[model samples]
Target: MVKTLSRANYPDLPFYPERMIQFGEGNFMRAFVEWQLQQMNKQGLFKGSTVLIKPRNQGMGPRLDQQDYLYTVLINGIMQQQLVNDREIITSVSRLINPYTQYDDFLRLAENDELEFITSNTTEAGIAYDPDDRLDNGPQKSFPGKLTALLYRRFELGKKGFTIIPCELIDRNGEKLKEIVCCFAHEWNLGESFLKWLDEDNIFCCSLVDRIVPGYPHDKATELEQELGYEDKYMVMAEPFLLWVIEGPEWLKERLPLAKAGLNVRVTQDMTPYRERKVHLLNGPHTAMVPLGLLAGLETVEEVMTDPSFSRFVNLLIENELIPMLDLASEELRSYASAVQERFNNPSIRHELTSIFLNSISKFKTRLLPVMQRYHQEKGQWPELMTLSFAALLLSYRGDRLQRQDSPEVLAIFDEAWSDQGTVAQSILSNSNLWGEDLTQLPGLVESLEANLRQLEVVGSRAALEHRIGVM
Candidate 1:
């Protein structure tokens, strides 16, 4: 008989009281947040478990149920100059509840006095105002709508407050979610008493979460299964590093104990510095390097960073153009940037440029454009790296001549915008929709970017980049 792995196999683990109601059952949340909870429980810092809510119909709810709410998390990355591969059976998720089907059970979860926290990763588009979503609407249309009904039900049963932590990758995500929930409550005419309860009782916490969780490496399952010695249908693979910054009141920290567990988790009043560091250093460089790296004949992040020319190009792009625009300390920024470079150089993770090339237009607007604008405003001159990055981005959409793979959808917009125009570079740079504002209005931005784009079109990506760095 096969020795089936059970809780007895992990006798060192701790069983905790279920206290958190997670709104999304996706891998990012499971591998990141729930994993942290498990870490805390083992250390005796936190004694609360999680009850997962399937906010969407199509997710891993069935798989999660089949696995008895347990999943294996594989963490692989460099630590102390050695490649560390650790696997943990995540049993912190006590149960899974699908509200669409099990509405009564879902509503009853709200009345559980032990439940003190609610968390969600409903994606950026999940939080919205749906006019048709009423309190009586069984299984509401939006995330906030469902949440509003739950909160009202909780309030009615008695004033039960929970700390709301939203992990959506949006600016002030918690605040935006709170605003939408309140709007839904008012529109539904769920009573002024409920609104007062919302104001007085609940806490909406803005949080920043960072972890590259590549869920379920199906291709490597045979090897992974042999290593783990058990079949985990909901296994998730992620990098070693993880950061969760919660912007909430100090009292909540006393309950969470994630810091006590020695994790890189912070409960802070102001998360602005953390946000700035992440956005400018990590996300900014990633966005800027994707097209540049892809066009330079690199397939993966490790390949790009391993190549001397492209690596140096990426470094210069960050140190010169991007760092000068930020207000953070030079040494701190450099340290973070260095770590980012190392993370990209990790041979274990195969983070692809094609995967990162989603919604390029919006990404450029959010990540790269701000730096471009700031550099122009402060220095009175356009940065070459920023200009080159934009040029490479525009050129990326023009379809690769060698590979014949089309650029992403947003890139298609740029292609059409400049199709009927004589001066392709000038036409693209002048488009308000693409650049958010009229780039022609900026003194040297249009000219520099246009010139770079022209050079890239003529000389190609590698040569154009070399020209910018004064090598060619």
Candidate 2:
């Protein structure tokens, strides 16, 4: 019989003062930030624990508490051309507080002298300004509002402010969070002294984090429990690649010496280059590949990466089209692109093309649209493979083959556009709501998309890919 994982069964765990407040109790935090802190603890480079507060009313706090805030992080991927499968028992998190139910306890944490850092991974929408939030609420509805009340609590207690680093996927997350927090302070009529303290004392650092955490290995739980002689309900599985780029002063490195511990964490004055590299190379390709891969009848990223025709087409897309548009060192971009390709090819990670298909139209707007525009501006022609991928995106939204997971409005627009009376390519391209700007404004884009759409229909995705591969 397997026992439940708890500190009672493993009493030799090290303890440290809770010096950080993490605002999310999700799997990504368990596998990424908390795991890094654990590494720092083991190396004796940092002797701090994390207090995780549920960002919303619902979370995994109770289950994590049941396990004594201990869980397993399973890393599986291709690293340095070798397949690596590893696991570690993480113990950096001291405990979790559900702010909705334990609001008093949550505020009490703001008074702790040891608290120095705040990290959050609330989704992109979590950082927005919510007019409905109030200062006196037990727990504010928005993440920013909750933070503002806590900061005000600290201010009232004459306690030092925290160095806040948000891990949300939005660009300049630190700035956006601070913006909302200030908005809350003014809306609540909090005095200028508090605003001064917020600006002068606290550090708001924007950070970019990259790792594909697939959360809870449900399929392998039984076998994994048998191997360990214990059951961990919070066990997280992730790819081996990890990167955390924090844009902050150089002195911040001493506080978080994750790089010194041989991790890929970097602290710099400007993380713009890193952010652009990730968005254009890794995220952009992932978005572009999904519809095309799904249209080719490939279910997972592994299938697309391993297939000859599809793989070559993606490689050409990155090298021939996307890489040339980026404002970074050629060798560095190529190295990162190579690493990204390896990550996509990792067999242990079965990234479903359809899963990546969620919010794909918006994703394309953010990740690929800018580069496409830049390429057109510089070269005076639409990129062939990228245009073909756009065609695939339009076709995938027809809702005939795959389940569409987008806004009702977006789905409806596609449905109407693909109707027999409407021209799918031109209609979508001309709708400014879809791509932010009318994509038809770009010369040759609509024509190229129409041509590619024709080819995709007549020859299918694989054959279309093969044609591009042949030309390249």
Candidate 3:
């Protein structure tokens, strides 16, 4: 009979003191951060466990507690051109506390003198200000609110401050979280001393985290259980490639010994290049690939990256068209782009194209637009592949082929682009408020997008891409 994965099944394993309070207990944290902590513990560079704060009442806390906060992380991806498929049980987390249910327990974690660091990945929308959140509530609805309450408790108990790192996808994630926390300090009337303590005591590190964690291998769980001889409901699947670049004081390098473990963590003075690399190379491709891949009948990133024509098109776009404009080293850009390709080809994680298609308009603006404009200005010619991708972006906004998740303003803009009977392409390109410039002024860009759109309608995304392979 298969048994549940818990300490009762394996009694010899050691548990360390909980030193880190992770605000979000999701797959990304377990697979990415805690996995590294497990490695750090083995090397004696770090001997600390994690206290979990379930961001939402998502109901995973009770299940996690039953298993002694243990879960397996399956790593599947390429390393040195070799396919690696591996699994390990992560025991670096000691307790799971739901602020929604165990608010007192959550607040009590602040009393532990060993609590040194805080990490969070509460999704892109979680780190925001809600003026309605009051300090008196058992648990505030916002992530920052709960955090402020916990910080206030720490202040009251005269505890040491924490080093906070937020893994939200926003630019300057740590700075933004601190901004909202300070906002709460003022709104909640937590006193000037508390504000002074927040400013002087805590260290907020702006970080860039890259790992494809396709959480909870539900489809392969039965097979995996038969192989492991234990049932693991919270098992997570992730790529082998990991990069955590955090910008903070140089002293953090001494405190966090993740680098001593020979892992991919970097405590740096500047996180700008790493941030740009992620947005332009990794995220840019994803945003550009969404409509193109989805309309081409591709289901996942693995399929798109392995298909001959599609694969070549993406490689060419990043290497030749995108990175030429970036200020970072060409060799570094190539290396990062190569890793991105390996990540996309990881078979275990099914990175759905539709998921990346959410908020494509703003994503395109942030990831691809700047590169496209810079390439044009510097080289005196429009970059063809990304321009074509722009065509895909505009066409994708119609909400026809892929599942659409965008603001109504974005939807209405696309509606106007499609509804304009005179010149759909010109109408969009001339809207300076949207694109920040009249794209029609660029030589052949308007014509290029117009032609690509026509080809997409006539021959479909695959055939259009196949034909364009011979052009650029």
Q: RMSD of each candidate?
A: 2.5, 1.6, 2.1
Where does candidate 2 clash, by residue pair? none
Best by TM-score: 2
Q: Show model 2 residue runs off by greater than 4 Å.
A: 420-423
Compute each candidate's TM-score over C-alphas: 0.93, 0.96, 0.94
TM-score of candidate 1 against the unseen true structure: 0.93
Which window of ten consecutive residues has the lowest lDDT sum in model 2? Answer: 55-64
Across 1-472, the per-residue lDDT of candidate 1 in tens digits comes to 2223455555665567889998898889999999999988887777889998888777775656666677889998775456878998987988888888998898888778999999999998887788898888668878898899889999989857889999988889899999999998788888899989998899999999998888898999878878778777788988887889999999877788888888888899989888977887888878887788778777877887887777888888888887777777888778777777767877779988777777666678888888888988888887787678887887776664423233454466666755756656667767776767776777876677778877877887888777777752
Between prediction 2 and prediction 3, the one with superior TM-score is 2
Cα lDDT tens digits, model 3, 186-227, are 998899999999989999889999888878888888999999
Q: Which candidate wins on lDDT? A: 2
Enumerate clash totals for all models, in the order shown. Answer: 0, 0, 0
Candidates in descending lDDT order? 2, 3, 1
For 261-307, candidate 2 gives per-residue lDDT tens digits of 88999898999999989998999999988988888788998898888
Candidate 1 — worst ten consecutive residues by lDDT sum? Answer: 400-409
Candidate 1, position 308, lDDT: 76
